[model samples]
Target: MTVTHALEGDVLRRQDPELADLLLGERERQASTLQLIAAENFTSPAVLAALGSPLANKYAEGYPGARHHGGCEIADVAERLAVERAKALFGAEHANVQAHSGSSAVLAAYAALLRPGDTVLALGLPYGGHLTHGSPANFSGRWFDFVGYGVDAESGLIDHDQVRTLARTRRPKAIVCGSIAYPRHIDYAFFREVADEVGAYLIADAAHPIGLVAGGAAPSPVPYADVVCATTHKVLRGPRGGMILCGAELAERVDRAVFPFTQGGAQMHTIAAKAVAFGEAATEAFAVYTHQVVANARALAAALAAEGLVVTTGGTDTHLITADPAPLGVDGRTARGRLAAAGLVMDCCALPHADLRGLRLGTAAVTTQGMREAEMIRIAAFIGQALRDEASAPRVREQVRDLAGAFPP
Candidate 1:
């Protein structure tokens, strides 16, 4: 969550000129280039204000009115508003906006549901899953025995039958779904049914598609998942924070886990921004943004495939598309570097059961800049040109600047 602070002029200059200059430089960088990072977005100005608000000074060490420390009257109000907005936005019985990040929210969910030795099933990180979903280095994997399910070798989509077979065999205490690089709509109901059959808790990590779910562009996991973990940023277009949504039955445990178990005092300022973002997500305007985001992603996937790039899963139903650049005669890592130098910003993910890596491109930021399918097609051409030869980058870079200027991020 690198914030290029567009602070209103001289206040920052008077305090720290160096930092203010750097912020402007970062803003210029974003303005001149394209952002294709799947798990990133440019939050609204209101969210930036909230992030830098005086609430950052608060030390309210507990939830709302139940704080261990005093002087929390406004903190309680702000948190309560965030909770209400989150629950209303997602149609959940309870919402906890206090987990410091997406990883912390996932940690809180695990703390609420599983003991140290409990078994959990999640998508493997190398194949587009998150680290918190049970990478060997993450706490979720170290503390608990974690088995993973992955997308099919040939088709780049999760196989539910494989998931069910693995669940039955492992008999995990929890079955986690939702992915960072996966480009299709998730079947939360199917995951729920499998969890029920295996008597496992279902934690849907909606970090990537929370906004889509809010706008009805994707299925909501709240109705089927026992717990939902998401970041307020990314496609949600909010602050750099995390939240958890669950039923009333698990509210207390989730809250306690987020508080003393996983993290200490809540970040009141970020929570306020989360509330603002949630309110925005509930609006018709944001719904349109989500729709455009999906449409642009699909268009980008098609355009890339048309250029002979191997777009994983054929195309996307959401804001992200994972493609292998091999057909362009470049490895994923080399392609990413060349594209960035050419003024397009994206990262690579490993392909399941393949030696080559997949590069994930997202449309959230560009959609925010008001670009649509036509722009996606153009950007894909730039990508194709750059990947064909680094010598083509100077021309592509100029094209990207003109395009980005037209949108003005």
Candidate 2:
């Protein structure tokens, strides 16, 4: 049998029957639901298999050729492949494939560049910035003094003028530009200019848009920022892991920070999976996939808005959209729960300086499962029905199952 068949057969015969049942059930649920979680995606079988490989048993406690542990030949190969693929995909001078998650990657970047108590500037959390950017509860905020920039009230979008003004006034060591809820394209070039004028480093958290960048569907921070951190799982469709990419100047510090300062040992299985994911991303089909993700998001946004919901910034330019359900007399939590009951998965998000008027939905997961504009329309209709009358959830749920059946996982 082929490796794929052998793996499948082994999973069926050797895995615990109960756990296997649960896995299959979850797969079915994903395949059937209108998945709209902004931070989730489906990995290819090759990438999935790589993540489950025996490489997971290895312990390579350092960078290639400088490991504290012995017998690292295979681990070295996996790490090297992951690094090379990342550099090729993002056109970076250096890439570190060892961060276990995006948060770790962010931590390593901060650890490498800033001393404790250094001033840092990032978008406010309520405005869609991530916790690692500067939430006081997170290391970035706790260790470094953090100032924030926010979206414009009139446009519901980032105000570059305000960013530059804040950068000049605060003179932070690092200025981060990216968000989880903002549904518009980032102006990386503008950010680069702002950072230069203020003599601050520009760090981009492309955790959500990395797939779009890889597919050439969105602008890349690789060419503009001093450091870029991203997760492999989101739109990149890899294992649950993270990577750090930087220019040649900061290469050594980045590697050391990822090793002794942040992580102990690299996860070889995840590295191998990242390599597979990067390879897949270089293909034309992946570009088409990224385009489809954005298209589906727009279609879904339009449908939701038609149902009297409010879409943040009017619409989306990426695979996710944040909507306001106040017109429907529902809070984000209520809309989320009602939609979940109707078999549509999404998350409730709080927007900055606004009453709890937003629900975040993404198309990456369903798009991965071959969902297109038609499916998004149907899903949006179901969400509308659920919000219109939570009592009609069962009927809408059946429709979701039928739609899911049309595209089995």
RMSD per model, one decimal? 1.7, 2.1
Give the per-residue Cα lDDT of candidate 1 at 27. Answer: 83
Tens-place lDDT per residue, model 1, 251-345, is 99999898898798888999999999999999999999999999999999999999989988899999999999998889899999999999999
Model 1: CA > 4 A from native:
1-8
Q: Which portions of model 2 show Cα errors greater than 4 Å?
A: 1-15
**lDDT of model 1, residue 267:** 88
Q: How many residue pairs clash in all the candidates, one count each?
A: 0, 0
TM-score of 2: 0.96
User: What lDDT would candidate 1 get against the real structure?
Assistant: 0.91
| TM-scores of all candidate predictions against the true structure | 0.97, 0.96
Question: Which 10 successive residues of model 1 have the least lDDT summed?
Answer: 1-10
Q: Give me candidate 1's TM-score against the actual structure.
A: 0.97
Weakest lDDT window of 10 consecutive positions for candidate 2: 1-10
lDDT of the candidates, in the order given: 0.91, 0.88
